[model samples]
Target chain A: MACDLSPVLLSVRVALISTVLNMIMGTILAWVTENKRFPGKNLLETVIGLPLVLPPTVIGFGLLLLFGKHGPLGYFLAEFLHIRVVFTWWAAVIAAAVVSLPLMYKSAKTGFASIDKNLEQAARTLGSSETRVFFTVTLPLAAPGVIAGLLLSFTRALGEFGATLMLAGNIPGQTQTIPLAIYFASEAGDTRTAVFLVIVISFISFLITYGLNWWVDGRSSMRKGG
Target chain B: MLEVTVKKVLTDFTLEVDFTISDGILVLFGPSGAGKTTVLQSIAGLSIPDYGLIKLNNRIFFSAAQVINVPARLRRVGYVFQEYALFPHMTVKQNAMYGIKGCKDMDGRYKLSVLDVMEMLKITHLQDRYPVSLSGGEKQRVALARALMTEPDLLLLDEPLAALDDKTRRQLRGELKELQRRWQIPFIIVTHDRTELNYLADAALFLRNGKPYRVLNRNKEQPYD
Candidate 1:
């Protein structure tokens, strides 16, 4: 029997969209947290990093509560905008984004923190606006780490299961991703499809992680050589 | 002319200074932790003082009493950091051209061109090269060129020769003095090297414990050995 490619396609799409969202949100959050000082800054950082330690199911439960029909945000959306977020492909994207965000944020934060502050000050003295200084000097220098973060986020989003299951539900040709499809296939005793998805996910994750390691290593060696 | 009267409390000492500097090279000579760099930073608008004013060429750069504080980008001061602080990802040309894009003269024309400053610093051949491949001396020239691109009213160099070799340091010292004269702008240099202080400074301010101990005019004195 021919393999159904819809799961693979949907998984890739969800991962791609989630990775882009993660990159933007993570970069901004990392910059603000890393450079600015304010009261309760530590609390804000801890909240952003909560997903790293919290179970995916717990996160999914929290999201479900927040986005449920009677919940405050859910009420506003459903009442005003007439949008339903639960148990949809969009829910899959949101679940993957939430779970993968911490990886991107931490990596981007480390990247921004490692740069010399003097370089930014130098740009300021040269009459560069703060936005210009960040875009021109700070962002470019931190690119390698940011790229690695993006890769990790994509892989993490691709492999997400429990959160997607709780928030989006496993519906064929709709919210079903590779991991969820594998789970359902095995439950139905379709070992062939399950094994095939497992191999595909493993291969994809292996390539992404291997590329990240190679890039990080090349960057460090380039720095040392220079 | 630049007039500075400010006070800032550091962990080990308090920096309090009231001085006016006119044309020529003025050196802040002090030990490492004596707050020399802090003084330069204050003048460049990078650091805020507890109280007092900083006036450069009749422009109020900062005034705590009047609550007037010009941001660093509008201060029109060039700061060459000790390590040069060149942008590692950019070519020398890009770094030199950075400030030129934002600056304009009275007629609304761009004040200085990148090629002009690069040629002045003798780095014309190295414009396409990145900072990572440049020697310390080349990096210093690129930094100076980048700073000069803004057409600053004052130039500040923090430990300008600290990162260079002995021979290169000696060579750049004469070039630096010539640059100040040619540009006809006030240049404030911070350094702990006695030889550099004696050789390049038209006057030197001796600082100890974040206070100005004395001011010496080198016009009539022999060089310190």
Candidate 2:
């Protein structure tokens, strides 16, 4: 039957891993850029955001060049700990993550920027430390935006194609994710599998986006009512 | 007595404000963008100036030459932001207790109960409500109660009455004035509303384009208009 669940399962794992890593990195990046004013801050933002504008294939290629076996980073890792990233699950995860970074960063940054600065000032004046203010006030208010960004990033990672393909070749049960599965199925004239996967992915995406909209709408209404 | 002097230069305007308030209301009266709020912000340690100094009861809050800038958490100042800036996610009770620590019940400490401040602010009924669910006046009262919970040495109100309706403003202004009198804490209120200034202020400091244009004592006058 060649009932291939490899792409389905592996892709889900890759998306999950990529989403988690992206959420952490994107949050930290957004917090830094939104709050601090260091030297060349604009430059740093532009550089960090380059992944958004650059082609996904280019990003994959860049990652490959920087972290391939002969690459300095890869060589150091191999010599130190004998870990190979090329054509591995980690590579697929990183590729998807790079493609999805800007989604998280942009959304989270907007969230952080929209928060009232006066609330934090008031907290500080009332004897709350910087750490306490962030956790208690800033994080709570920023949760909705962060959650929205994370979910969007997860969805994008689920559909990541160009970067994933370029960085990690489609090895069945290894680096082959759902998108790759759909592509290979279509190429092989297995229309039933392709159509089924497409329908499943479409249904899930639809549900997620609809759920997000409902949540945001309910949140705003709840706020207004409260 | 709290004497603050700070010289801060924003991109558009330079703020060089100095004043001292021992007791009663020190109204920072100014038109919009006159840097009146900047002065209060500097006092609260929110805005740090490039030069000058701030001293509260002989303790230096900020000293450019000494390179001493006391952080806001240790300053014991109460601030009411122009919009109140209540915590939208928390209930009114949680908001009231937001900045107050529990050290008062444990050992050598001073504290006010959340219930007390809520009752004082007349927000006891709204204790379970969030900021988004609160009316403008309710939010202001909650902000006041939250700031009061810390039992601050000096209170700063940055146009606290600007967001309410005329009737609500008039009503809250009276309540705020009464509260101020009862608390007996020096207050620095930034506002251009002459009505509010006349009704609540004992002394008025007029700011024109980031400078103190004049300082008037309203104690003797029977406020009109």
Task: Report, to 2 decimal places, the DockQ of model 2.
Answer: 0.60
Off by over 4 Å in 2: A221-226, B11-13, B102-107, B218-225
For residues A45-125, what per-residue lDDT tens digits would candidate 2 score against the true structure? 887788888988999899989888888988988999999998998999999898888889888898999998888887788
Report the CAPRI category for model 2: medium
Instruction: Give me the candidate number with maximum TM-score.
Output: 1
**Residue A133 alpha-carbon offset, candidate 2, angstroms:** 1.9
Candidate 2 chain A lowest-lDDT run of ten = A1-10
Against the true structure, candidate 1 reaches a TM-score of 0.96
CA lDDT of each prediction against the hidden true structure = 0.91, 0.85
